[model samples]
Target: MKRVGSFLGDWWRLVIPYFRSEEWPIAIALLIGAIALTFAGVGLEVLFNDWNRRFYDSIQNKNETVFWREIIFFSWLAALYIMVFVARAIVSPYLRLRWRRWLTSHYLAHWLDDRGYYRIELTRAVDNVDQRIAEDLNQLGQYTMTLLLGLLGAVATLISFLFILWELSGPLSLASIGIDITVPGYMAWVCLIYAVVGSYLANLVGRRLIPLNFMRQRFEANFRFSLVRVRENAEGIALYHGEKREADSLNARFIDVFNNGFRVLMTQAQLAFYQSGYAQLAIIFPYVVTAPRFFAGVITFGVMTQTASAFGQVQTALSFFIDNYTSLAELRAVMDRLKGLQIATDEKPPTAIEVMPQPGRSGVATEDLTLSLPGGQALLENLDLPLEKGQSVLVRGASGTGKSTLFRALAGIWPFGRGRVRVPEGARVLFLPQKPYIPIGTLRDAVRYPDENSRASDADIAAALQATGLGHLTDRLDEVAHWSNVLSGGEQQRLAAARAIVFKPDWLFMDEATASLDDAAEATVYNALKKQLPGTTMVSIGHRPTLRKWHDRQLELKRAPGEVGTLVEVPA
Candidate 1:
């Protein structure tokens, strides 16, 4: 019972927010319409049950006139049933889609806000968030609507039919057995018992499906992610001749999917077999129990048939869980995954380094800044670094001395330490990494990115491209393609340099941004930065001796064998 309560609480948290959102009016209207249709469909089933009795009795009594009239009545009844269900089908799915849209937008905001995606990735706190957002949200919306409507319809059917079955059931006497006992509404009691037992057995057969479905989604996402990795890094793999290794790794991932899928299939088969036999037995069980009364001539053929129809309706309504146990299991798994993502994103990082805006300040500076790995090993300690406006400083360190991490801490992304980083209010800062991210889009957008709203005209963009020795791509500004895959490494670095030229940030931090370019090309890019944006404060991390001439001062990070590194000012 506690587990059930927790499951429902999680489901409510995931489902209720959309209805209370700005789209509530339309969402509520569609939901109410679908529910109204559900009740109308159940009401129509009652009418059909009555018609079944009239038609069958007409045939039993050889009354053609009454039989023909009842047949026409069924036609009208069937038409109304079709219209109600059709409207329900339309409204329900439309509501699901709208709910899904709202949820996708909401989750995307939380995941991207405050660089939550980066933190989640850096800490390995959650896995396959893309799948959770893309696939799990869709399933959550779909199954929530399906199960809610199904359960409501079941309740209505059960209420409407149970009374009819009871009234038609009458009392049964067992004096011939010498006990002289009587059972009231015997058929209703029998149906209630039968449905209860069937549901219990169905649950027993399919309870493992919940955990299996959860793992199944994870395995499938892992396999698909592996394929995407291979595609994205095709050049690296091909150059290293790692196709065979990739193939074996891919097969290994798929084996998890294959084995789990086989177990799901076998479990579903067991459930299907049980449900089919139960349903077939239900068909005859109703008439078999009530037939004795019909044979005894205590009721008309119409009453016997009506009693059987009512029995079927009540039994089906009670068997709702039995029929949908698998869907229920899948829904449980979806809720668990989405709830996990929600919790992970909502959590605040502990001991996060603080970055504050100091208005009226001229450039970036750090106070008592410390940096560490995710595993809590200190890299840099008690460092106070300050730079004034228009000052170009180069940061130099041996490999793994936290040069790049210091950049991240300055960028306010590395959260594994505590410190205060101060920057001027409303300062535009850009960090160009070793391998710049080239979004899959047109060349213009890729160059203007991290700020797609840049108003840099085509002429301005083209000039930046030419300045960075990428004049060949100027004409293809509007052509959309996967820029990362299309551009070579040196070309990509040059393109990133062009982006820096276009963006013209007040403070530009480049971490080996020119490492891939040739000496002449790198010189051209650095000279362009100096001439184009002379007021920009530059902090670069690089090992090349040629890089020293472009900066006014230098800071080197040095550490002993087992001590944390410290930054020291050095002559350029």
Candidate 2:
């Protein structure tokens, strides 16, 4: 009872969001329609059961007219049943798609909001959030519908067919042992007991598999992520001769995959041990109990067939828990992953400073700004910084000294900080990371990402690329490639700069966005920034001395013994 209650709790927690989403009306309507159709199909099942009695009786009687009449009756019933089945298939997948769409967007919204995805990545809180969103979310949505429909159909079958089973089978007797066992609805009771015992045994053998499968997914995702990391940094790895270590790292990740998979195989073998033999025994158990009466002329051939049919129905209903146990385990694994993500999304770092409102001020700004790491180590502390309209500056700090962290804080991505950041009304801010993100698409589409490609004209894109010294790319603007893989690092970095030139935001914060380029290339990117949007407030974090010349002033994070991150303003 306790376990059942807990399962219900988890199910509700997983399922409630869909019914409350913007697509609720369509989602719920199709859901209810699918369920209704499922029950309708099951109702035809009961009709078929009744038809079995009448049609077979006519056959045994050798009555041609009644047999033909029964045939016509069944034809109509079969047609209706076919209609229900067709409706179920069509509408169920429709609901599945809608649910998947809503769920993916919903999870993405929470996961990506305020760089929640980045936090999840940095903290390693959700080991397979990418897999969960892309793969598991779709499976969860689809399989959840199938499982719910199955449960409903099973329940409806059990209620309607239990009567037929009880009426068909009676008490059992073992006269050889001088024993008599009187059980009303004896076959139904036997199947119920058999299924309950079998389900318990299956769970006992398979319970460990739930955790094993969960770990297996995590391991596979880790291995895949490692491979992707290698691909992303293939040049650096080759230049440094790090192939041996990379191979060792990949081998270790595969080792994790191997061990987790071995455990799953062992547990599945244990399950097959019981379910296989149990299934083999099921083929004959009904006949052994009913054959004696049939041979003794107590029941006709039609009666024998009816008895077997009823036994199958009773057994199927009783074994619902047994059959669905594997799916339940898989569901548990998905639930745990999704539940972990939910916990992470709901969590807010306590160190984040509240945004202070100034009495006479009108735009967005921060006061007494302080930034810290997730471990509570301060990156920027007790600093008074202000930005006014048409003002631009550069922020410089040592590598990994939280210059990127400050950028994240400013963009409200990293929550582990103390700062009140304020910006003016109707101000649009864009943050450019070190590597430009080139989505897989036409060059035109990649340039205008986070906005539809149709929303931007190709001529305008060509002009921006030309201005950024990427005129060669302008001719291939409509061509598609894995731009990250196809374009050189310098070009990809410039592509981001070109994006800035095209978007023309009110403010742009570049975090080593041109680190891969040469001094000349870096100078060209900045010149493009200045030429395209001279009034756009620009703040950059870079190490090159030449970069300091691009900005009017610099704030460098100075370090000393016993001090990790202390920002010291650099004189212009």
All candidates' TM-scores? 0.97, 0.88
* Per-residue C-alpha lDDT of model 2 across residues 1-572, encoded as one tens digit per residue: 89778877887899988999888898889989999998898788888877887788889889899999989999999899888888888999988888888888899999978677777777777677888888788778776887888888888888877777787776666555776655677777777777778888888887887788788778989999999999988988999999999999999999999988988988888887878877777767878877987799887667667767777776676677667767777887887788888888877777676544345553445577788666677666776676555656777866777788777777776777776777765666778999878899888888887655335577888888988889998899879888998888889988988888778777888988988998888888899889888868888888878888888767887654235567677898
lDDT of 1 at 267: 98
Give stretches of model 2 more than 4 Å off.
Answer: 54-77, 171-182, 230-252, 353-366, 387-392, 445-464, 560-564
Angstrom error at residue 197, model 2: 2.0
Candidate 2 clashes: the total is 8
* List of clashing residue pairs for candidate 2: 364-422, 364-423, 364-424, 365-421, 365-422, 365-423, 366-420, 366-422
Give the best candidate by TM-score.
Answer: 1
Q: Compared with the true structure, what per-residue lDDT tens digits does model 1 show for residues 417-520?
A: 98899999999999999999999889999999989689999999999999999999899999999999999999999999899989999999999999998899
Locate the minimum summed-lDDT window of 10 residues in model 1: 557-566
Q: Model 2's lDDT to the true fold?
A: 0.80
